[model samples]
Target: MEILMTVIMGEIANRSISFLIDKCSSAPKNQDERLHDLQRLLLRVNVIVEEAEGRDITNKAMLYQLNMLRKEMYRGYFIMDNFRSQANNEEKNSEDGNVSHHFTPSKLNPAKRLFFSTSDNAHGKRELQQSLYNLNNVIVDVSEFKAFLRNYPPLYRQPYSMHLFLDKSMFGRQMEMERILNFLMLPEPSAPPITKRVAVLPIVGVANTGKSTLVAHVCNNERVRNHFGKIVFITENDLKDRGLINLKDRDVVLQPNSPLNGNGQVLAIIEFSEDIDEAAWRSCLACATCLGSVVKIIITSRSEKITRFGTTEALVLNLLPLEAYWYFFKVLTFGSADPKDQPRLESVALDICKSISGSFLNAHIFSSVLRADLSTTHWCMVQATLRGIMTRNACLSYECCVNRKNPVYVRGRVTNDLFAIYPSTEISSDETVPETTLPELLLGGVRCEGKFEVLALKSRIAPYKNYTNTCEMLTPRSTKAKRHQKPR
Candidate 1:
């Protein structure tokens, strides 16, 4: 039985070591499950050790095993510790917790402090075992040992994932964003009180138009960050499933007075796709308006028609200008400003800019694909590819305008009548017209009196085989003798 118990204890120790190694191998985010698994392995080891007759392992051996575990686990702990330290520093700079000092290290127990410190040497493990041995003989409470393990640095790393998600200082976007805090803070109109307090601004454009990028930038801007008391970003799935229900549970309600009711004014920035149904869109809009009378809900979408559904106060961002295009080009090329490459590439870039027509996303993507090649031959090839895309875009634009199911009319006049000759076709604005004299051509059509002229009846008449048939069609059922006029 003694031999069997010793074998079992050794097996448990080996298994515990294996478990610790596995936990160290994975990411810090998965530390919760790893911690639980480690605890279970340790419990098995403790059970087997207690059952063994002559297998009373020395505290030195246990400490040696712990040292091995610490070395293996230190990498993950170091990464998490560094992240936490940096996060805390940022929080302190922002005065987030109203704390004065920023560089404070977390207070930890002796074992954890030793385990985490980079200065701890191999001999320190033996010293720690000796200290524990001396403390164990005293009539002290045994609960302290459990508390020490429970408060270890490894346990601290277990909650790192939650911290990562909740850390607002870590969230950011790459582009520059404009803030309208001053505009929103303007006092309510005094004269005829405008009841429409809530406003929704839906940004619409085609795919790769930088909608999300713009939203992200605007949300992370310093002005917006400082002005709003509370800002929350809700994903599409969350909006659909809960419809701001979770937000309400968090005490974030959609009410105008509530904005001022809390600590200060709160602005909730809700982002959703254009694909959301009209009802869901309405729900999101309602939520925004509920937040405050001066609530500004900014939405990004690929459809132009989303403006008609909710609030009419929508602003469309014009596509990138030439200056912005150059800025974006420089960014994509990583500041490779060679004029030799520019002359050949400028025309192609212009054509691409015109084709994409101000979409930052498109420009960025196209530039990224081309920037991979450093050779002049690749630039030439890119020019060729851009020309093809331009041609295709022109064709698509024409098709979209011509083949629309319900064509738009202007002042009760059918506009499609002019383009009925060719369906889904477009003529360039630069095309020249054929030379022809209007009166001469019409006069040569038919003769009247002494001069060559066409009857007024023929000019205004409906479709007919010839001028005579046209005249007959217009010579109406009215018997009143209307004077017939002819060309002089």
Candidate 2:
């Protein structure tokens, strides 16, 4: 019993010393100040114990009273530090004259302080006085001592566990993913019978084409979410174990057996790689086909070849139209929509769209890079840079098409002076032709293929509506053909 009392007294002394150190660190500095404060606190504890001795306390009762006194001293020191720190910070703020008037004290910290102070005051005096009145009553039974400790309110320290709370953006993504699952499982008229129509969809496009964002948008759309039973999305460049492939397969096979059933209408959207090896492609395809007719698989990739593998049809995602690009740009620049900046923002957006030529990825990235600082000079620079890039790309595309050896042609009607023919390729008209006579060229290489005949040419005439040049070249000359003609 004496040993237990001694341990309790030691704990109280340690807590008192720690409280004094914290207070001194924050207070106006004085040499050896914390040591002096701790000595003074200990002297007060000794005085309380001496006062209890005069009331006829036995050895055991005196020890219990001393432990109680030490606990009270520690509690008082902690309260003093709390008050001193607040006073010190307020003084510093007032002296500097920089503290904001908008600031308000926290309700939680002050409430905790009041609760601790009330309990310490009630227990320390009553327990000490009762122990002195009767030696027998001074020594507490072990069970009652435990009960006292339990009944006392706990000290409120600054919490470290509050970090578990999530931010808004993370929650939004989770909600979006949930909504997409609903859309992918929706019933469709074009859907194949529950067993045969199960197919994989690979959405392939170049870099920055908004593949992830498009998937997010489709999943979030109310119409799509309501129609589908289960929509599962597999993000790109993840390993097999991370639900890149295996998790997707389980969703299709184990969940629902029929498209009409709640689980069977699983829309598995996968991401394919630009340079995926044959083994990986085969594995991905096998996983996709596991759902039979009920599964609709969609993959987004930069490689066109990846889309063609084990798939019936593919839809190419084009660049965003001008208006959509404008909306995206506005959102990126200002957190909220600003009507005053609309004209300047639109001009900048249009220039970027033309340069990227409908590439949603390019527009998104470029907009992000320029979102900050909406200055006139910055907008002008962005426009000039995009125009330069567009001009360069056009020149390169034209040159590449023109240099190819194969003759390219587009089917179009001929009329008027020039035979207008649409070229099948991007080559320039001037590069292919040695002569201006377009009609004589058309008749030279007319060849038959099965039922249809084709005319191959080195070059085609401009202004495709005109055919007068073609007619003159096809006309027979009066002197040359008659002598060679046989008597009919």
- Winner by TM-score: 1
Distance from true position, residue 335, model 2, in Å? 7.7
RMSD of every prediction:
29.6, 30.4
The lDDT for every candidate, in the order shown, is 0.39, 0.42
Worst 10 residues of 2 by lDDT: 162-171
The regions of model 1 sitting more than 4 angstroms off are: 1-179, 187-199, 249-264, 275-278, 285-295, 308-312, 321-327, 334-336, 340-342, 345-356, 387-488
Give the TM-scores of the predictions, in the order they appear: 0.36, 0.33
Q: Per-residue lDDT tens digits of candidate 1, residues 244-341?
A: 44444444433333343453345555545445677776666666555544555666665667777545455454444443444345334433354323
Candidate 2: stretches off by over 4 Å: 1-197, 221-230, 235-245, 248-262, 275-282, 288-293, 307-312, 321-353, 365-371, 378-488
lDDT tens digits, residues 329-377, model 2? Answer: 4444444444233534544554454455444324334554455446756
lDDT for model 2, on a 0 to 1 scale?
0.42
